[model samples]
Target: MSLFPEDIASAARAIIADYAGKAWMIATAESCTGGLIAGALTDVPGSSAVVDRGFVTYTNEAKMDLIGVQPEVLAQYGAVSRQTALQMAAGALRRSRAHVSVAVTGIAGPGGGSDEKPVGLVHLAARCRDGRLLHREMRYGDLGRDGIRLATVKTALEMLAELG
Candidate 1:
């Protein structure tokens, strides 16, 4: 089924409501999951009060241009590494008026499998209100592009809850 993870939708609603009550805005910089995290948040009726915007930076150049990710970071660690994820999140928080931001980048594919960075290699990071950043990496196995993205979105939602 090409559908969203239901657990994510439930958690996202709580996160949205929490941030809305705090009057804090959030943003997303997405790659492997496109804008699914944003979509999940927007699924909640009052999400507009907490979500400011989302940036789907699916390419390295887009990540650099839209989120201010330094070229040096990409050159040193590539786009799917923790360093890049941190840069992406920080850049999103810096550029957007949102109080916080999350970033995701990875090779979510059935063809991009490799020993180092396999098909389900996802890296996630978040920049919180106090200017702190948290990052996590996961290999969701070869669940194909959609599956990997869905799993990533679910994990991202958990991270969002922690951020909330």
Candidate 2:
């Protein structure tokens, strides 16, 4: 009955349950997928206990202003790189009270492909208050914009569960 895919739904539920059980809160730093990852987490019935905040940094300025991503970093690595993803995750934790956070930056597009950074190239980073960071880079091929974004959400949720 849910519009979200089964993997996403289950992962969201698991993240909420696990984090809430541990009395831990989560934050999100999102791009490409907009706030879809945060939306998935909030879809759970009692997500409020675990979800502290979500940053929809769709633009470079937002990423810098809201989450403290450095201008030099974006200028050097661009938004969709592992460096930016790590910085975004670290920034989310620094800017919020969450015990853990996940950051996603990607090119979910039908037109943004290039020889190097093609469409569906997503970089995900999860950071814990304990200072542990995990990163995943995925090449989802040309699955179209919606497909790539949804896939990123699913992957981000799974990473949240793992971090939880």
Over 1-164, each residue of candidate 1 has an lDDT whose tens digit, in order, gives: 22446687788878988998899999999998889999988888889898999999999899999999899999998899999899889888888889889899999887866788988999999889796677899988888888898899888888877877
Q: Please give the distance, in angstroms, between residue 39's alpha carbon in candidate 1 and its true position after superposition.
A: 0.9
Alpha carbon lDDT of each predicted model? 0.88, 0.92
Structural RMSD, model 1: 1.9
Model 1, stretches more than 4 Å misplaced?
1-3
TM-score of 2: 0.97
Candidate 2 residue 31 C-alpha distance from true site, Å: 0.4
Error of 2 at 2 (Å): 3.0
Looking at model 2, residue 125 earns an lDDT score of 98
lDDT of 2 by residue, 7-120 (tens): 888888888999999999999999998999888888899999989999999999999999999999999999889999999999999999999999999999888778799998
RMSD of 2: 0.9
Evaluate residue 148 in candidate 2 and report its C-alpha lDDT on the 0 to 100 scale.
97
Off by over 4 Å in 2: none
Model 2 accuracy (lDDT, Cα)? 0.92
